[model samples]
Target: MEEYPISFPMEKARTIFRCSVITYLRNYHRFAITAATFVGIPFTFAILITQAILPISDLLPIVYNRLRTLFFAAGFPPTSEFFFDLSLKLSQTITSLVLLLPFTFSFHLLAKTYVVRSFRNKNGSYMSTFISLFFTQIWNSFLVLSANSLSFFLVSFTFSCMEGFGFKSPNVIIFVSASGGVLYSILLAHAYIISNLALVCSGIEGSVGGGYIAILRACVLIRGRTATALALALPISMAMTAIEALFHYRVMRAYRNSNNITVIMAVEGILIAYLYSTIFVLDTVVNCLFYRSCKGLNLAKIDGLENCSGDDSAEEDMKNLI
Candidate 1:
C-alpha cells in the first residue's frame, strides 16, 4: 500500500548514475566470465534450436511435396492430402516460439539473479533463485508485453487517424514511432522497478506475491515521474537495442551466403542474450540504489521503515513470526 515518491531529479540522477556505473563495473567484472559460462551455453542451444526449426520449416513443404508424389504413385489420395496438411502444421511449428518467450525471459531472469549473487557472495540458493526467476519473468514479461502491445495499437491507430485527417502519412508515422519509443521506454522502466521489487520481496518474505504491493507502488511512481523514470531507463535501453541490432545484422548478413551461419548465430545469440540479461540484472541493482536513495531522502518524514522482517533480519524475528 506504500506509494513511491516521484523519481529523483535529473541532475541528482546523473550523479547517482555516475556512482552506479562505477559500482556496476567494479562488481560486474568479477561475475562476467562465470555468468557468461552459465548462461551462454544454454542460450547457444536455444539459438541452434531456432536455426534448426527455420530450416526444418522451410524444407517441410518440399519434403511434403515429395511424399505426396510418392503416395500418389502408391495410389492413396487421402494419405497424400494428410501429408500436405502435416506439412502445413510442421511449417508452422516456429509459431511455438510465442509460447517459449515466457520461458526464455524466465531463464534470463534466473541467470541474472545468479550473477548478482556472484557479485555479492550472497549465497543465493539455485533452486530458490530459479523459482523467483520463473515468477518474476513470467509476470513481468506478461505485464510489460501487454502494456507495450496496447500502446503500440493505440499509437498506430492514432497515426492512422492523423493520416485520415490529411496529415502527411510519413509525418504521422514518424510521430507515432517516436511516441511508441517513449511509451516502451517508460513501461520498460516500470518493469525494471517492479521486477526488482519482486526480488526484494522474495528475499524478504520468501514469496514473489509479496512483491505485488511494491510492484503496484512502482506503477504509481512511474506515472508521477514519467520523464525522470524514462531517463533512468535510457542506458539499459540503449544497451539492449545495440545488442539486438548486432544480433539481427550478424544473423541476416551471415544467412545471405554462409552455411555456417547457424553456428555463428548460435554463438552470437548466446553472447547477446547474456549481454541483455546482464543489463536487466544491472537495472535491478540500479533500482536498489534508487530505493535506498529514496529511503534516505524520506528519513525526515518517515521515522523508520516498517519492521518487515527481511531476510537479513528474519532470524531475529523468528520468535515473533512463529
Candidate 2:
C-alpha cells in the first residue's frame, strides 16, 4: 500500500474528542431527562405490564420457551408474530410500541448529533437538531443501523455454522467468538462512522449526494485507516459494552427472584436509557470530530486524526469549486 501524506491537528483533535465526551457527561442530566421520559418510562411500562407486574412464574414459561426456540433455531425476523402476539395480561400491540417506538425515536435523536456538533457549536439547540434530524437524517441512519444488524447476524450465523462441525470446545468457542466479534465490531464501527459522515455531508453541505451514494463516498474517503480508526473507536465501544455487561450481571444477580424479571427489565431499561443518552452523543460527536479532522484531505483520511498529513491540492480544489 502506498503511503499518502496526511496532517491533522492531532493534539487538538484528541482534546476535542475527550472534551466532547466530557461535555456530554457534564450535561448528562439534560439528556437523561429526555431519555427517561421517552425511552425509560415506556420501556418500563412495557416490562411491568408484560413481565414484572405479573409473577415471575407467569412470564417464565414464555421467556424460557422463546429462549429455547431461538437457541434451537434461526432467530426470528424483526417483524415476527412472536414479537407481535402475547398471551398474558398485556395488550401485545401497545406493549410492542412501548418497547420499540421510543427506541426508534431515540436513535434518530442520537444520530442528529452527528450533524449538529459537526456543523454547529455547543450553543446550538439540541431540540432543533432533534426536530431537524427527524425529517432528514433518521431514515438514512435507520438503513445503516439495519445493515449493521444484518451484518452482525450473518457473522453470528457463520460462526454457528462453523460450530456445527466437529470443532467445539470452551476455549475454541471463546477465542473464535471473541476474535470474530472484534473484527465484526471494528468493521461495523467503520461503517457507522461512514454512514454518519454521509448524513452530515448531505445534511450540512447539501451537495454531497443522498443515501447510499454518500455513504459509499464516505467509504472512499476512509479507505486506508480502518484499523487506526478502530484503535481509537474500539476502546470506547468496548468500555460501553463492559459497563453494560457489568450492570446487567449485577442486576440479574441482585434481582434473582423468579418473579422479578419485569423489575429487572425495568431497572435495566432506566439504566440503559440514561447510559445510551450520553454515550450515543459521545459516539456521534467523536466520530464527527474524526471525520472533520480529515474533512478536506486528499488521502482517504481516516483513523489517524493525529498523524494525517497529506496533499492540500485536492482540498483546495474542493474549496474553490464549492
As a whole number from 0 to 100, the lDDT of residue 88 in candidate 1 is 48
Shift of residue 187 alpha carbon in model 1, Å: 5.1
Candidate 2 per-residue C-alpha lDDT over 84-181 given as tens digits, one digit per residue, 9 for 90 to 100: 23222223322343445555466544545433434442334555555444544445555545655565466457556765785656566556555655
What lDDT would each prediction earn against the true structure? 0.50, 0.48
Cα lDDT for residue 26, candidate 1: 54
- Model 2 residue-pair collision total: 11
Report how far residue 177 has shifted in candidate 1, in Å: 9.4
Model 1 / residue 156 / CA error / Å: 9.7
Q: Write the per-residue lDDT of candidate 1 for residues 1-322, one digit (tens) a residue.
A: 2222223456445544544454556555544455545664354345444543554465556655764564344333242233355334434432434535654665555555664443222455767655654565556656656765565456556655665686765554455556656775565566665566555444422344323544554554444444554566677768766765676576655766575558767677666767755665566555544443443332111122122123332222221211
Looking at candidate 1, the ten consecutive residues that score lowest on lDDT are 299-308
- Name the best candidate (by lDDT): 1
Counted clashes in each candidate structure: 0, 11
Give me the displacement of residue 132 in model 2, in angstroms: 7.6
Name the TM-score of candidate 2.
Answer: 0.48
